[model samples]
Target chain A: MSNDNEKDWPLWEVFIQSKRGLDHKHVGSLHAADAGMAIENARDVYTRRGEGNSIWVVKAEHVHASNPDDAESFYDPADDKVYRHPTFYTMPEGAKYI
Target chain B: MELNEALFQFCLRRGDDTHVLSHRLGEWCGHGPVLEEDMALTNRALDLLGQARNYLQYAGQVEGKGRSEDDLAYLRNERGYVNCKLVEQPNGDYAHTIAKCFLFDAWHLPFLKAQLDSKDEQLAAIAGKAVKEATYHLRHSSEWMVRFGDGTEESHQRAQQALHDLWTFTGELFETDEVYTTLQQAGIVPDLGPIKEAFDRTVNEVLAEATLKRPEDEFMASGGRKGQHTEHLGHMLGEMQFLQRAHPGAQW
Candidate 1:
């Protein structure tokens, strides 16, 4: 009997860009009965003041993640890769606006 | 009256409509059945309040008055307010509030669209900006109307009852009053007669989509634009004006 109530809508993660030049940032999650409702809910929750120019809502279950144990192998290798760093490049004598 | 006077009156009407409706909608903050809906109602309220501020400030400037937007909002008596009676009604429940919004938002969105090209530059500018906000309001309310109307048996029954109950107040939105008539003569505002046609089309389409019937054969309520109001307005004003009434001119 409670299954009808317990089978709540899926949770969706909302991402919004506050303005035209801004990057989309994750705001919050909302439970919606469907994808369309999720998008509408995201708008209501995130864009009340003309804050967002764009929105993206994805079901939380669809997100893929790497194991924390693989962090060293996955991300540590890039940390010491100084050749991949742009810091080695010397600035010109006078870069006015840089 | 001069053009500025007409524009001032026009903006006051517009501002009062938004401000009162926003205050009414704001009552739903945190009280909505679901969290998402709670946020939706509050968000719409904020949008309307913001628009009201803009319009009221413009109205003050046009009137060449020293009063700020808050003064116009808080100091005015009930008779001075020009909002349609539909907005001043109580938010009885979720379905009731949604039904009220569905009716008003349907009219407001299209009406604002017509104002985008108003002869008055300021009015046109504000309308151009507000049209987008009103579009979302209409969409959000319309969607809920469909969902609730076609949802569970109890939800459907409640939603239909809400529509019928609030149907009388809807006519006030389209009533062409002296202010509107004078403004139309000056080309400062759109003729609401045409706007009503569009409003009816949109409302009927939404009602059809929701499988709800159009309410029939009831005498429509009027007089909000003419300063007469329902008994509910007094209670609403008493609460809304408490802060200002208690501490006159006091501000943080």
Candidate 2:
């Protein structure tokens, strides 16, 4: 019954960790009935080519993001702040651990 | 039977099981209920095909007749195949397909795990790799079984019907003959007793969780291991082997 229709399930955001000591990166999204099925769907859809050793899936609905409508006022102030960038300072020669 | 012949038969049985089931699952290429399911089923089919090639290649080598994997796979006729009948059964509905896959995966996982301890190095290695694939396969199928059997009324009825219809064919999975007995005696293969126990435990656990009743094992069918099969195998082979049979040495 759950698989009777694609719309019956909710979309899940998939994150895959390619190897050890790596952060899980958002790959794509797929539909599944629950977290278990979402993890499995993520594995099938994302890890088929040995792309990842670990997977994390969150329901798309649970992933909150800033509204684009507030982008200009909420983010544009940082555009002209050149001092925030480390490029303004010159690095010493042979400074390997910068 | 001679030792070489028994070993060949043993490999062929396992090979044919995966080969035929892969073909059956492949038939769902563009036909799954959803896009995700389509890919998932095809993925399982590919896994089975990989295992099939390994077993079949080993079978050819064991035969020592210079037959390659492709030759044994593409040239085999209906009677030449030794897969159990359960793998050859038609994929009826979604419920039927899940039932077929679940039943087979339950037996397949443990069987391959036992093969990991095989006295023969080749078989042991193959089993080592195959056990991993079969583990996920069993999980997927068993999850689907729970979904179908515990889902809506319609799904419950369909799953029940499919299980009842397919139960009889399961008996042959544990049945043994001289070929298997010989291999078992030589320590090349494990005894069926423990494998059957594992199969039963998994089946009972899954069925209970799914809220589905176990069908009575009665009038069990046999002979697929001996190359005797239902009419289905012939029709399936006609389509599966058509290209190979029609044009000799055809290649991409």
Candidate 3:
């Protein structure tokens, strides 16, 4: 599709980390033609006051997110896997705090 | 010579330029073409006004006459101010405003970067913090300039016309005077020639990217730094100083 029309700019998801040692959390989505333009649009929209140390922009179409209806099936499986829990095992003697 | 004497004048000039331009930009607060751009312009304007407050407060202290930033800002006469002419022009349209900002911010970023090495500690500190802000201002303004200039035929015509209308006022930014010469000799200010060269390169690059030609052989407007200004400044000062002039020593 030609993205020259006013409504043609594809939506891009914006993820921003406000500082170092922080995870990039999804802030919002804005429309842009490319990743570079998406980053600029995100900066203009989200980070007005030196707020973010890093930014990640992904085309909204490319995000492989599970539907809400599958939340139980996708997430509940890990909850019952108690062997994956670290609390089940005791620490070795004189082991550093974990 | 006393440092405060020169510093007071320098800070007022800096403060006035930012204050006037910020107030002008604030007019676009609710009226930007898009919501993102609306926020962008206002955010930049707020940043400029914040910088103005810092510099003006410093100017008050350097004057050492018990005046506040508001007094320095709102009590000054037209001849006593020293802001450049480009900032006081009316915000005719979005393209015009963006073009004016691109022109000024292009000069300001390098100017502030050089001032980081100033002999005056306070000026250097102010310039150091301001350069970071100025870098973003240049980026935002240049992005709009390029977009509008290359977007559509109507946008292209408007942006190019704005550039031509504002180009005359740009020469005053590089026009030097005795204060600049004295400061430069004393290592307190950067040489204008090099700053002008860098400004030219950056502006030309952006214009080329926008597919717009730079205006040529125009009669350059001058004398803003020396207190001469266009008629627009009178109207601006009238609005800006009305409260202070009406209620002398009024506090909020």
Candidate 4:
């Protein structure tokens, strides 16, 4: 059964965490009537093979995005910020988690 | 029947229910109300079919008939099969399908829990795997029941009507026979008293949350366990077994 009231409910971007330490990585997108339905669909679609320990679904529309049109100018400034990279500081020889 | 033979029949009935219901759900594969719902329904169908394969194979082994799972499944006639009439009922609508599933899963979850104590270790092990799937199915169906029951004028009407139509079929789930008795007495199966009790509570809670009234206990259809089924099953089996019947021992 479907809640067909919404002709096109909305698109949801599915994210799945394969294990506890892993991030909820974006897997794919599906259309669902609500958050509950979205999460349910995501579980069936992306995690059927025990591929995920956790799931996170966000409305595709709700996610903020940066304009690719401004790619030349917007990200050019960060390209020179070498200190922002952790590689700028040498890790201790004994570092593990780092 | 001897206890082992009784248990074999019992397993066939249980597996039959899953097989028939899975086919009904499979009918909704491409025709679901929505794309996601379509996938979801087929996903459930696949799950039920997986369980059916395991249970039916065990039943075959127990019968000592040398029949493979496919033989028992595809070769069985109407009288040879034993599944509840509720499952054989048509997928009238989304609401009807959900109601059917809600009722079945309510009983299945508890039934599997009780099966965890069965003297039959293999049955208990299968139940261990099945109960988890049943839990998720219950959650999904219960959510839809509430959503449809409380959603809108149209949804409420459809959900209520579906419940009323399907209520009569729910009684057969608790039906008992000599085989069931033998199995239970032998501890190969659990008493269904607690299973029925749990089902009642679940149906009531979901109906209450959905603002839907439970239909009064009036007339309940029975006899499926005796190989007496509604007209639906014959038609369903015709479609389901056509390929195998036409091409005996055909391999995919």
Q: Pick the candidate with the highest DockQ.
A: 4
Better of 2 and 4 by lDDT: 2
TM-score for each of the candidates: 0.87, 0.95, 0.87, 0.93
Tell me chain A's TM-score in each of the predictions: 0.74, 0.77, 0.68, 0.77
Query: Which scores higher on TM-score, 2 or 3?
Result: 2
Q: Chain B, candidate 2: TM?
A: 0.99
The DockQ-based CAPRI class assigned to model 4 is medium
lDDT of each: 0.86, 0.93, 0.86, 0.91
Worst 10 residues of 4 chain B by lDDT: B32-41
Per-residue error for A49 in candidate 1, Å, reads: 6.2
Candidate 2, DockQ score (0 to 1): 0.47
Instruction: After the best TM-score superposition of candidate 2, give how far the Cα of residue B155 lies from its true spot, in angstroms.
Output: 0.6
Candidate 4 per-residue C-alpha lDDT over A1-98 given as tens digits, one digit per residue, 9 for 90 to 100: 44665566889999999989867899999987789999998988888789998999999989999999999898899998988888867888996645
The best-first sequence of candidates by lDDT reads 2, 4, 3, 1
lDDT of 4 by residue, B60-149 (tens): 899897998899889999988899999999999899999999999999899999998899999999999998989999999999999999
TM-score of each candidate's B chain against the true B chain? 0.96, 0.99, 0.95, 0.98
Query: What digit string (tens of lDDT, one per residue) describes model 3 on residues B68-151?
Result: 988888887888779999999999988999999999999999899999999988889989788988998999888888888889
Structure candidate 1, residue pairs in collision:
none
Candidate order by decreasing TM-score = 2, 4, 1, 3
